[model samples]
Target: MGGYLPETIVTNDDFTKMVDTSDAWIIERTGIRQRHKVAPGQRTSDLAVEAARVALAAAGRTPEDVDMVIVATTTPDMPFPSTASIVQQKLGTRPCAAFDVQAVCSGFVYALTVADGFVARGIARCVLVIGAEAMSQLLDYTDRGTCILFGDGAGAVVLEPVEGEGTSADRGILGFDLQCDGSKMDLLYVDGGVFEDSNRIGKIRMQGNQVFKHAVHKISEAAENAVIKSNLSMADVDWFIPHQANQRILNGVADKLGLDRDKVISTVAMHANTSAASIPLAWYIGVQDGRVKPGDLVLIEALGGGLTWGAAAIRL
Candidate 1:
């Protein structure tokens, strides 16, 4: 796994100058001390490319070896060509099957699930799965509720097929449980889109209370169901790496699962919510800090707009 954050950092106090919010208020409510922001010329694909390079290097592979590229991002640089395509060209990757997945914060897992299918079916030998977002690009700086809750970053992983006994003990993605409730769209959504005649992009709009309620419930249920599908239980998981949406939500999910807090990998306090990038970013941190190790059983999950939520069980 690999992760990348832009050089610019926005602290809670910085939001105080932009909106009627304070460091204490932001930290107390969202547990976000600061977040990374893209520079003026930076875009989602830029972050994705850097992250992909790091992941490819870590896997001891190169762009030429990649057979497929999947990028999960809501804030793509443009609407025409996919971000994965942009990353491919920028990285000088050979022509390959490339595209984008937009499940928002649950994107990484969604992308991972797709990559798994391709490799499992012997369609792709080396797949680069990335979750990247320039969330700041879509935020309304004046809207304290949304602006203070996001940042820009990317995380990536290389997925390749491995011989496994087809059991829960497999040292790779074992199972996944994905679900979405379009009916709950109002709970979290962007207010504008490409359909707007003004050609203006919409800012994020969220019903925080409603989202918090659903996130805690759905995330926990999805995680549990995923582990069960892997023929394993919560106790078998060595780490719980979830979307870094909110520290409260992370704790809430851990509590619901009766899982130890120490077992959870969280980066929200530092990165805020990088949307799709959160899971892999946190996973990268955990591994870097030596808190997470190879061969460990990991359960990753996330909830995002579309009321989309899912979980993946893996032995890494």
Candidate 2:
């Protein structure tokens, strides 16, 4: 996996200058110290392309080698041409299947699941799955509840078919579970959109307390389900890479899974929440620091704005 964060950094003190918040108050509540933001005129596809190039290089592949591009993002560069298409064009990849999956924060896993189906069925040979977000552009900076919890970044991974024995001992993605509860959409969502407010873009709006409660429960449940589906147990998981939503929620899910806090990869303090990008970003950090490695059993999970939640088990 390869990850990219913009050059700009936004600190908690910066929020104090814009809203009725403080460094201490923000840290005490969200455990976020700083986040990165894109420069003016930088688009989400820009981040995605940079990350994708890194991933393709790391995988020893060229743009023409990719047979499909699936971008998981809520903040698309445009409504007509999907961000995946923009990324493909920017990367100079050949004509191939390109699309976007908008399960909000659960997007990466959702896209991965979709890609798994294609590769498993021999429909695509090589696929680029990216979770990129320009979340800062969607933030209502005045709303400390939402603004402080997001950052802009992109992460990408290349998935190719790895023949296995059809067992949990498989080399690649072993199993996954995707879920959503539309009834709880109001718990976390944007206030405006193309169809909702005269084609106006909206800012993030969330009910912190309620989303926190559900995140802990739903994220844990989906993770456990994925492990079981893979014919494995939590004890078999070497690393717990949950979404970087909040430190409190991350710890809560780890506790519920009985996972050692040290085994959980967390980047929320520095990266805050990158929505769909969180898992791959955190995974990239772990790999760079020598924590995550090939053949390690990993559990991934996330909860997003659609009230969507999902998990996947893989042997990386």
Candidate 3:
């Protein structure tokens, strides 16, 4: 696993001058003390390539060893020549399948699930799954509601096939439950796109209350389905690494699942919400801090724009 956070640190206290918010209010509401931002000229793929390098190194492999690349991100370097392809070029990987998955915040898990299937089918042996975003580019800094909730960061994991009997007892990517309800996509979205008059990326907009309501239920439902699919239950899960959307959503899901607070891997306090980058970023932190380790039963859940929500189980 690997993660990369930009060097520019923006604290809630710093926002006092830029927006109508206080340190206490931000913390009490979102549990985010600070967030990172990319400097001028840095693109999403820039952060992504750095993250991919670290992930490949941690796995004790080189870019040439990569058989496929899948990037999960909402903010791509551009709309064409997929971010995955750009990463491949920077990483110097050989020609192989490369693409991007844009499931918003649930992207990493979605990409991980896809890689798992590819390796399982013997189509690829070593696949790099990355969740990266330069979300600061899309934030309206004056909009306190959305600006305070996002940060710039990237996380990656290299998935390799571990031959098994093809059962729930597998060592990697044990089970998955993914779902999306697009009927109400308006609750959280950006205000600009290709057809928009603004050449720049659009700022984020969100209905906090509506998103909160769906978050608790969808997150819990995904986690429950994932655990069941793994032939296990909440009691069997050793860790819950959820998207770092908000402290309240994380806590609510934990309470609903009857899981201990300590067992949850949360990075929102420091990393804020890096959209799709949240999961692997949190997972990397958990591993480094010794909270998650080999043979651990890890459950990851996320709810993102597109009203997408899902869960993935892995026996590390």
Worst ten in a row by lDDT for model 1:
193-202
Q: Each model's TM-score, in the order given?
A: 0.99, 0.98, 0.98
lDDT string, candidate 1, 1-316, tens digits: 8899999999999888899999999988999999999999999999999999999999999999999999999999998699999999999989999999999999999999999999999999999999999999889998888899999999999999899898877888998999999999988898887777557788899999999989999999999999988999998989999999999999999999989999999899999999999998999899889999989999999999998999999999
Q: On residues 201-305, what C-alpha lDDT tens digit does candidate 3 reach at each position? A: 788999999999999999999999988888888888999999999998999999999999989998999999999999999999988788888888999999999
Candidate 1 vs candidate 3, TM-score winner: 1
Model 3 Cα shift for residue 174 (angstroms)? 1.3
lDDT of predicted model 1: 0.94
Q: What's the distance in Å from true for residue 220, model 3?
A: 0.4
> Which pairs clash (backbone N, Cα, C closer than 3 Å) in model 2?
295-316
**lDDT of candidate model 2 versus the reference:** 0.94
Off by over 4 Å in 1: none
| Local lDDT at 28 for model 1 | 89
Query: What are the per-residue Cα lDDT tens digits for candidate 2 across 1-316?
Result: 8899999999999888899999999888889999999999999999999999989998999999999999999999988699999999999999999999999999999999999999999999899999999999889978878889999999999999987898888888888999999999999998887779876679898999999989998998999899999999999999999899999999999999999998999999999999999999999899989999999999999999889999999998
For model 3, what is the C-alpha lDDT against the true structure?
0.92
